[model samples]
Structure formats: C-alpha cells, structure tokens
Target: MKHPSVRGCSAIVLAAVLTFGSGAVAQAASAPATTPATTANPLDFYITPASLPANNGDLVRTEPSVFYVDPLKTIRAQASVQRIMYRSVNSSGVPVAVTGTVMVPYAAWTGSGPRPLVSYAPGTQGQGDQCAPSRAMATGEEYEGIFIAGLLARGYSVAVTDYEGLGTAGSHTYMARESQAHAVLDATRAAQRLGNPQIVPGGPVALAGYSQGGGASAAAVELAPQYAPELNLKGAYAGAVPADLPAVGRNLDGGLYTGFLLYAVTGMGAAGGLDLSPHLNAAGRAKLAATDNECTLQSIASSGFLNTAQLTVSGQKLSSLLELPELKTVIAAQKIGNGRAPQVPVLLSHSVLDDVIPYDQGRQLAKRWCGAGSSVYFDVTAGATHIGGYAAAIPQAFIFLERRFSNRSAVSNCWLYG
Candidate 1:
C-alpha cells in the first residue's frame, strides 16, 4: 500500500476538476426520459447483416444470441447465435471495423428495466479480428481473452470494440486515449442501436478493460461523461492499466518489452497523423513498414523476441529514434491513467510485481482521485504479476461494480487503509 509522495501531484488534481466539471454540465442538461424506441429497427451507426462484407473470411459467426443484464440485480448475460461485421470510422475518417459476434443469455432479467451495459476494450492481440471479438466466441486458443466467459456467464451485455484499425483497416491505436475511448464508447452506442428484439434499451452502463483494454477503458471513463452522457455510466473497472506510457516506454526500452514500443509507434503514427516513414530515412521507413500488419507472435518469432538493441530501422538504432524530442513528447502524453477522474465510481487494480507496467502509476492515479473526492477503490494485488493480477482482481472488480449499481456504498478508503 505504498503511496507516491503527495508533493506536486497537480496533474491528477487538474484532471479531477475537469472530470467533475464535465459531469456537472452533463447532469445539468435536461436529457430526455430514457425510453425504448418505438420502432424495432437497427441503429444506423452500426453495420447491418446486408451491409457486411461478403468475404468476411472465417471470422464470422451466424448464430443467434441473447445479451442482457439483470434489471433487478447486478448479473449480466450474453448468449451468442448471430454475428455481424462491426464497422466505424476513426477521427482521421479512416474506416475501421471488426467481425463481432453477439450473444445474450436466455435467463437475462430485463423485466426490472433496462440493464447496465459493459462495453469492453480489449488488449493487444495483433492485427487480426479472430481474437478481438468482445466475447471471444470464435474458435482458437488466443481467442480466449481474459473476461469474456466470466462476464457473459454473469449476464452482462458486453460489446467488444476491435479498436479503430486492427480488425478493420489502417493501424490500430495501441494506446491513443481519445481515439480508443471514442471507439469503445461508440461501440456501446452501436450496440444500443443494433438492439436485439429480446433485449431492452438504455440500461445503466459500465466500462471495463485490461492491459491495452485497460488503457482504452480508462479513456472511456474519462470521456463518457461528455462524449456519451446518455450511456448512464454507473462505474468502470480497469486492471494492469498502462497508465503512464513514458514510464512504461522507459522500462521497456532496449529490453524484452520492446515489442510494445513497436506497437506504440505504429499505433501513434496511425492515430496522431505522424508519418513515421518520413521520420526515418527512406530505408528505415521501409524496414518498419514491412513489420506493420504482422501479428505479435510473428514479430516475436522473426525478431527472436530480442530487445531494442537487436532491432534497428534502416541501420539506425531504436534508442536513437526514441530520443527525439517529438517522439518523447508523444510517449509522455500517452500515459493511460493520468487523465481526468471519472464521474462515476471506479475500480482500479494493479500488481506491485507487474513485469510490464509500473505499479507506481496505479498508486499515483488512486491518490489523485482520492484527493479530488472521487470514490475510487485501488486494489494492489499482492505477489501477482500482469496476467495473474488481472485474474485475481476480476471477481472483486465485478463485486464492486455490482454494489455500485445496487446503490450500496463501497469501502472507498481501501487504498489508504491498506
């Protein structure tokens, strides 16, 4: 339960103020009463069955499924039966979409009212859509992402965003906060519009993500108050979040974690409108471009999972490119959790021994939120590494979320008490 020194934690404080201010504005607005649309029609923001690409390849599922959350309790369910290609455009106007399978459980309790929505943002699994579906209903080992089974089993309607680029076109925004947040929130909007006749509309909504997904979830939390105020977000759960990008970059630099750097560079280039090809001389850009769409496994296999030292761009060292002030500024800005405190309650979890992301970032985030008067539960899982920490924290995270929606106050001082 070690806390970062409180001196000069103004960045977090500013974020908190901004978060509250936005929430206040949204709350003050006279929003229309929540209602189910009279017409049982699909939302235009999402792609319908007919508009989907014919050659969706092997990633499509044609089974009918039910997705809903308990109107009375906190449980949720997503049963899969039909699949469609989800399409959306990025800030750059680049069209990005993914093949998504929707599933809702048969026992969903929508009678109490509209259930809460859990729009999930997934972590890195390379540029393929096969493993990026929100529910991991597709066949394959890598497709078994961390929380899909558990969440669907609990009756939560989970809309997974394949991000802006990976499953659709262009480059995926690995950790671009605004872009990732927009994609995650918009996907939830898409889900509401692409409503199943069996499911109710406009339920309380929540956001969750792990690792890269964690980054996206954090962004969604920060953005939901303003971007999609109608979602009625009750809470957010994020674990092993890459909150501080520069800190992570420094730790991973020239080490085994360099693959993330590669992904970051590509993602940033795509999201920020930076042309890495020009930054590197002609030959350097060519070498980097060659590795663009390859999956993480392919990069590791071909590169021997080597550190940055073993990798080079057009004969230039990786460290040299990273040293540039422009790149440094961008990396510094991509830290995940440093943004505004969310309007609703938030569950933040991290492990001290996390091999990838630094634990200090999570601690700092909690401290900042607490100071800003946010009800945050920061759980530091003992002796858990990245993957292990996520597993250990999920049950508690869900429990905390359940309590929030049930109108029960959580033990908000857990971080300080520990």
Candidate 2:
C-alpha cells in the first residue's frame, strides 16, 4: 500500500511554497493534476440504508440538495450538492449522527490526472441548529460561503461538515476534538464514497479550517493515520488552533466568551456526563436555555465579558466545573498536541496577539508536534487579531495545499528532531 515518497517542500520563512519534486512536471502537464486513483461508481463505494456501523468512522447516507452559494463574488452554478448524514464517534468513542454537505463546482478537471478535494471545516457559527453551515449555505447566507466560492473558483471540489448535532437533532459537542475530527474526516470519506468523478476517487486531499475548525483539522490529521487510513491526505492548514483546552478555558471563563463557555460546558456535559445544573444557579440555567436558539451575535452580545463566577452557586469560576473525573478525561482527549503525529504535512498559523485562544498555546502545539517529528509550517502573524490571522494565512495556505496536492513532500522547520 506504500506509494513512492515525493520530494519535500523548501522550509522558507513566510515565503510562498517553492516548486518541488514532480510538481513542476505535474503543473507543466495541465491546469493542475496529481497522482490519480481508480475510477468508481456511486454504489461501488457507499453502502445504502447504511446500517449502524460498529466502527467509529463510517458514512451513513446521502441525499441530493441545492447549495445556494451566491458569495460576494459569483461563480458558475454548482454541478452537484448533497445533504449528507454520516456516522462518527464522539470523544468517548460512542457512535453519533453527523451532518454535512459536499459540493462540486462547474469547473471540470482539465489536468492530466483527476481533481483534488479539500475537506473544509468552518469555525464557530453557534450552538443553534440554524447556525449550521449546510443550512446557511443553502440560502447563500452563510458568512463563509463567499470564502467557499473562492475554493470553487480554484477548480477544486469542496466538502464541508456541520459537525455532530449542530445541524441535527441534539446538543453540539462544541469543542470535543474527536467528534469534530470524525465529522470532518468522514465528510471526505462520504464524498469519495459517493463516487463523484469530479472528486478524483484516488486524488490528493487536504484539510483546512480556522479557530475551532483549526483545532478540528489538527485532530483530523493526527487521527487520519488510524481512524480513516483509506484517505490519501496530503496536508492540513490550521489557523488559530486551540491546542490546550485547559488554557483556553481559563482564558475565556471570565471574558467576552461567557456564552462559549456555557456552550462548551453544556456541550461536553451532553456528550459525556457532566451536569451543569448542580453547579449553575437558577439565573445561569435560564440564560443557557434562553440562548438555545441564539446565533453568534445574540450569544456574544448577551454574554460578552461576563464572569461565570457570578452565575454559579458557589460563586467561583467555571473552571471548577472541570473538577469532575469524567469531564477531565473527555477534555484531555480533546486536547490537540498530545495525539499521534500527522503523517502528512501541516500548516499552523496564529496571530501573536489573539485574545480568545492564547498565542502561546499555538506555539506550544508546533513545538510539541515538531518534537514528536511532525513537519510543521508554523507562521506567527503579527498585529492581527484572532480573525485577522485567518486572512493573513490564506495566501500561503493555498501555496501549501497546492504543493502538497501536486505530489510534493513537505519540509519542516521542526529541526529539533531528537
């Protein structure tokens, strides 16, 4: 099952990726292509009426749908789009229902080989079912739909997951890493299993996400080596990764992210067994329920900069909620840097001045993963805020994906390889 090792990318600091290995040859052949895999039919891959899988990563079912992706910049009509429900495991390894969408652009593969696919994970929208990417993308109203349009313009197929429960009939697991990673990776598996010729059944694939999505992408890359090894993941681009849940929690507990804390605590509680009713006072309980249908604006505006200590019965910080044994175990599994090293290359970007997820945690992620022998392309953006860092990282992020999809090996700045 081993493929030949391609040449590695140049370890440049803040420069666009240089031509490497057979990339130049591949590019010289056509618009852009890579090592192709075998062709397939829809049923040849997916199991219909997909019975409950005993395994962790599985594709449940898919139904065709329209994607109203009219971004600020318009592109050709979508060739195909589907609303898919798949099977994935939570942080505790229990099977859960996950939802997402797969879209193919009007652009066709003009290259010598098949087209590349990018499995994109959107950052926090909200805990509400209305905030799901598939729901928003349907109306061309999703904030990130414009960005997705850009990917379609690049002539690559795209698959986006709404994570488990966000768009479905349950509470979102929020920051639970395993659930997030399973949803993202399974979206790719579901797309390929659909046997879309535009997807290049065996072509190179990449992962991209920012913030919560970034953390999910990091988890996907680490888990990809085992959970879904059927994929040929070439690279992952993660922006503002929340590598340390403990650190992130301590920072957000008494700040503008009070609603997010509620979401995470309640989310993990729902997934695991941490009940907040014992810890939260009556007002806190009411606020949490009132925000059930609230989107980002509503959640942030209502709970911003508030301290959880005032809402709790003991009047202490929300961090105390993590004192429970099962909760601590789930949160530890959600931490990103402690997992298996990514077999593929990874691009990690973070703003040095991020207010939400600390910049130091991102640095720690790179250092620890590099120490574990991961090829990391670390970019520390200057002056930008948490969201701004995503914009700053996009240009080079594409370069990273292009080089990887073109069949090049990735070089690392992680030289402390002892």
Candidate 3:
C-alpha cells in the first residue's frame, strides 16, 4: 500500500486551504456565545439490531446497572445504582450521530439538590459500543467506576461521550479535536436536557479524560469559552494527550500501533471530505475502504491493513498517510489551542515511559498554554505507563477540580513527586 501522491499542484493547494482554513475558522469561532441550537432528535439515531452486521460479535443496545456507595454509606450500607442507555444519533451534522451512554444515579432524586455535572471523554478504547459506555459499571467489568461512582456518591452528575462514530455509522476520528470536542460538550448538553434533576443547572462543571480523551478534553476546554458558555467549565484534566497529530503519526506508523494511524487517515478523510480512493490504486483502495467502518481495536486485529511498500509523491511511506505534508500543513494551521489558552485552569499529566503517545507532546502542550498565560499545572509521573499514569494522576485531578469549583487557586505541589 503505497502512499497517495500529491501529483497535481491544484490538489496540493486545495489541501493547504482546507487544512489551514478550518484551523482559522475554529479559532475565529472561539468567542462570544453563538445562539445554542438544537441537534437532531437523539432517538432518531438509535442503533437497532437490524443495523449491525450478522457476523459482528459485540454487545449492542444493552442496559446494565452498577452499585456504588452513597454519602450515607458509612451510616448504613446503602447501594446506589444507575440505569444506562447505549444508542446512536443522526444529523450530528456529520456522517455519524455519535454513540454513547447516559447515566442517572438512582440517588439523584433522594433529596439532593441538583448536583454539579462532570462529562467524561474516555481515551481510545474501540469503536464498538460494548467497550465505551459512559459508566464503567455498565460494562459489568471490574474497572475504575470509583471515580465515576464517587462523583455520584458526592452528589455530582456525570455523562460520558464515546466520540463521534465508534458504534455508529461513520469512522471514528481518533484524535481529531473539533469532532471530539463537539461530542463531549454536546453530550453534556443532551444529558442535561434529558431532565435528570440531579444534574445541576448553572452548577460548577469539569471535564476529564486520558490519551484520546485528553485531546478531546483540551479541545473542549478551548471550545467552551464560546461553544457552551452556559455550562460552568470550572476546570479540565488531560493525561497523555496526543496534542500534535503529525508527531504521533510518525511514531505510530508501521508499528503494532499502526491501527491508530489508519484510523486517523480514514477518519480525517471522512471528516474533511478527502477522497483517499483516488490516491490509492485498486489494491490500496480496497484496503482503505475495508477499514472505513471498523473500530480502532478491530482495525488492528485485521492484518496487512496498509500498503507500506510504496511512497506518496512527497516520498513519504504509505504508512505516513496521516503525516503527509498537506495533512501536517492543515493540522498546524488549526492551532488546536486556537492561538489562546483555555480560560479556565488546566491540569495536564503524562508519563515519560508512555509508548503510545510520546510524553514530549504533553510537555509541549503545557509549555504552549503556560506561555500563552494560562494557569496550567503540569505533572510528569515517574515509571508510569499510559494506563498507570492515568490512575496515579486521578487523585490530583480531583483536587484540581475541587479547587476550581471552590474559586481558589489549586494547591500547586499536590502531585509534584508522585
């Protein structure tokens, strides 16, 4: 699978414009509340059994309940539970409606005045709905629902966005900022409208995610000053964010992590209206098209997913599709931080041993925001892998959110040596 050629100067020019123009558009759109608009009815986008492939062996449209400790648990063992829904959407104004779960704690109605909301954007899991529910307990797996359940226990409402596509109709735009940001922010809005009284109105709110979620959280932070100003975005915590797309593409190509690269190229193509088939020959097109609907993990499971033997006219490897000069030009132009740092305080953490997303990107992002005069607290966890780093960083993340909601500067050295 050779890389596509930028043979025609016209194509090169057009790519340049789309890449840079969207960036400018994103930046220019980052201020003053635009009148909030209603997205299409979410029920109209449900993922029915008939919609899935017969051979697809993943769970779909299933509801699960989770048990948690409420604030009164110490007095008497009271079990708190939440019912969650996993469904799809249409008219997100993109190819997919985005699939995710909405959780309403049973204790929400128990005399607790509306609780503050926390919308979580999870890191790269897979495109399948089975793996990306908003609440960890919904999966019937013993992972970390503690953070989520603890928030609920403390009387805070939470909603999680699985990102656009994934369990729906389009490709998952793995780390694309705008799409990810829109899903997280919009889902919060949708959850609020879902009429769970526990979801506080005009309450202090926060955003948190690791890796891909970190990238989305960063974009949500940047987008909130204008996109959803009504929601009190007190703070954000991003861990091991793949802030620089080109840099990540370079490190992931042709390695075991290459599936992410394919997802990026295919996803961006779908989102940006680039026709990759024209660049690929018959065989290349087949490979690219085959992955259009696959999730991140599924794509990796399939073999020979890319034509790594050839090169684009720019002499880049076929696997470098995501790192094409034209793509890089577009990404750089977007200026994800939008030439300004997030208005709210930010906490960013990364591990030096993270092989998936290089730690340098995290450092650069912190430097960029801090240099732009944003209050950013950066932490580099020692001897932590990507997953371990997230756990190690969570306690501090809670502290950061707590301080922001309390209207005080976060204690700077809380996670300094962890």
Candidate 4:
C-alpha cells in the first residue's frame, strides 16, 4: 500500500477483494435461525442491539454457499464457502453484529493433527456496506481473487470478518483496534462452531493479514489471551502493520493519499456517531457525504491530493481531525503497542520503502512487543511499497504459520537483538 498516491487505489480495495474472492460472510441480525439458501444478497437485514444475541461471538446463522474463487490448479478441489453471522464486541465492549466468510478445504487432514484454521483479515476497503466482501463476491466482482485462492490451495480453512457495522446497520468502526480484533477472533469461533465436516474444533489456529489486517491480527494476538482465550491460537503473521494512525494522518495530511485520511475521519466519526458537520466546511462536508457510499477506489479517484485544510472551516489539515478533543482519546486508544504482548510467536514483516504506513512504526511495534517478552521474528524487506509487502510477506508468512500449526516452536529472535 503506497501512501495516498496511486497505490492507495489498490490498497483501498485490498480487503474487499481478498475476502470477497475468498468466501462470503454477511450480517444476519434480523434474519431467522436459518439463512436464506442463496449468496445473492448478504446485506438484506436490519441490525439492532435487541436483534443481536447476548453471547459474544456466538454464531447467529450460516448460509451454505459456493466460493467464487479463481482456478485452483491443485489444492484439494475448491473449498466449500459459507456466509456466517456472528456476535462480537465493539470498542465500547457492547455486543455488536459482525459478519464474514468461512472456507473449508475439501481434503481431510492427512498430514498429522486436527486440520488448522487460518483467520484471514484484509486491509482497508472503505466504510460502506456496499464494501462488504460477502455482498461484493456474490456479484462476481471481488478483487484480489487469487490471493485467497492460494490460501485454500494449501489446505487451510479460512474465516474473514466484515467487522462491526460494515454490513449491518450503523457506522463501520473501521480502524478501532478492539472492534477489529474481536471480529477476527470471533469469526474464528463462529467457524469452529459451524456444523460442517470441514471445520476442526479445538484445532490449531493461525492469523494473517496485511496493512490494516496486519494491524488487526496483531491486536488479536494481544487481545486473545483475555478476549478469546479458548481459541487454540498458535501464531500470527502481520505484514505492513499500521501501528500508529496519528503518524499516518500527519504524513498524508496534504498529499496525494488524503483519501485514506478522509476515510479514516468519516469511519471513526460514524462509529462514534459524531456529527462532523461542526468541524468540516462546505467542501469537507460535501466530500465526506459524496464518498459515504463509494468504495476505496472511487474514493481515491475523486478525493486525492485535495488538501484537508481547504476542507476545514479553520483551514487546518488532517491533523485537525486527529486533535479533536472528543476524538483524541479514541484515536489514541486505537494504537497497538501498549497492550500486553501476545503470547503466541509473531512473524512481522515491513517494507523498507513503505510509503503508506511508516517502516519505523512497524519496527517500533516489534520492539514494544519484544520488550513485553513476546517472541517476534521481525523482517524488514526491501524495494516493495506497503501494498507490495503482501506478496513478499505472504510466501514467508506461509512457512512461519506452517511450522506453528505443525506444533513446532520458533527460536526466539529477540535474544539476538535485545
């Protein structure tokens, strides 16, 4: 994911494409016990707190469906896909509706223990219901069609979360750390409880994501010990993780990538129910309203290089949003490093030339997690920008997760660097 430049175009849609092509998961808060028999419409529902069950991460329902994935030259015929509705907590710890896809490979476990699960989180797609992967895939237009195909080809069951409010009612809590983490972790539980032949309950599990997803995977690592301790999590591979949102906002303030910054503002505000009309001038208000229903690519194409200061009544840049008295705490709370170090071994990768998320922040995150005594294998790869890091890190992440699922321990790299 390059900064708000042309790279934002691809990065913005990364999550939407990855999840849609991989499988489908939809919000079913108002649906009956049984899901409708088709993947044609995943967003045909209304969500209310009264509509959600009391249990956190509980499986609300499941729609048995086919995965609209690319050609799998080898890996176990195509995997079976399902649209799932699950319960999860929001930033405020309230039980909220969440949705995502689950894919179970056809091949049985022939290697060793119970078949392992991979919780896949995609990068930023946008802040609209239309951006939901399940809805997009059902339409046969999911991007990154090949990314998830490769994962299924390796014989792993995958679960992808749409996060709170993305497919349901209310605003999407786009980068809220706790909410995203809960969605990722709960989606795994939903998959385990699924009444399917493919899922192996109490099996080893691994987490993987790039860019925004990478950050969520990292958040789940720290949160799982308390939030979802029952999960048999083995390890996580987070590449191009965005540990510092404030720094990102400042960096992209007046640049070509301000679209991401704009998305962040609207997303965070929507989650908090903050009427940003007070802060934005006519231009800012018009831009935000215009991009509300659009996905990342459209958002970028229309709102790039436009200065955030010009949109504000006070002529301040994106930093103005970061500093809003009501929003400051929320933004700070979204940072990832201060939390407990995830007990599982972590494989973290970042590109030296990453323009979207700073490389230093990734390194700083590794250092913090290491200080907290977590076993971390940090990689600083070269040449690739933020989005390109996915291709580079994924192949290596595959090996790292493979060893963990096989119950192998990683030699601690912290001792050498610390």
**Better by lDDT, candidate 4 or 3:** 4
lDDT of each: 0.58, 0.72, 0.58, 0.73
After the best TM-score superposition of candidate 3, give how far the Cα of residue 269 lies from its true spot, in angstroms.
Answer: 0.9
Instruction: Rank the models by lDDT, top first.
Output: 4, 2, 1, 3
TM-score of every candidate relative to the true structure = 0.73, 0.83, 0.70, 0.87
Model 2: per-residue Cα lDDT at residue 379 = 80
Q: What is the lDDT of residue 7 in candidate 1?
A: 14
Model 2 ranges off by over 4 Å: 1-59, 69-79, 323-326, 416-418
**Candidate 2's residue-wise lDDT over 1-418, tens digit each?**
0111111111231122122112322222222222213226422222223356555435566666555433321322344677677777777776776778887765566644678889999887777776777766655556555456556656678899988777666778888888889889988887887777777666778999988899899999999988888788889999899888878888887777767777788777877856668778987788777666666656777888877787779988876777667788877777787857788889998889888889998888898889887889888787356656666777777778778877777867776322
By summed lDDT, which 10 consecutive residues of candidate 2 come out lowest?
1-10
| 91: Cα error in model 2, Å | 2.2
In terms of lDDT, the best-performing candidate is 4
Candidate 3, residue 328: Cα displacement in angstroms equals 3.6
Instruction: Score residue 309 of candidate 2 by CA lDDT.
Output: 81
* Candidate 4 segments whose C-alpha is farther than 4 A from its true place: 1-36, 39-42, 45-50, 70-77
Screening candidate 2 with a backbone cut-off below 3 angstroms (N, C-alpha, C), the clashing residue pairs are: 256-305
lDDT of 1 at 300: 43
TM-score of 4: 0.87
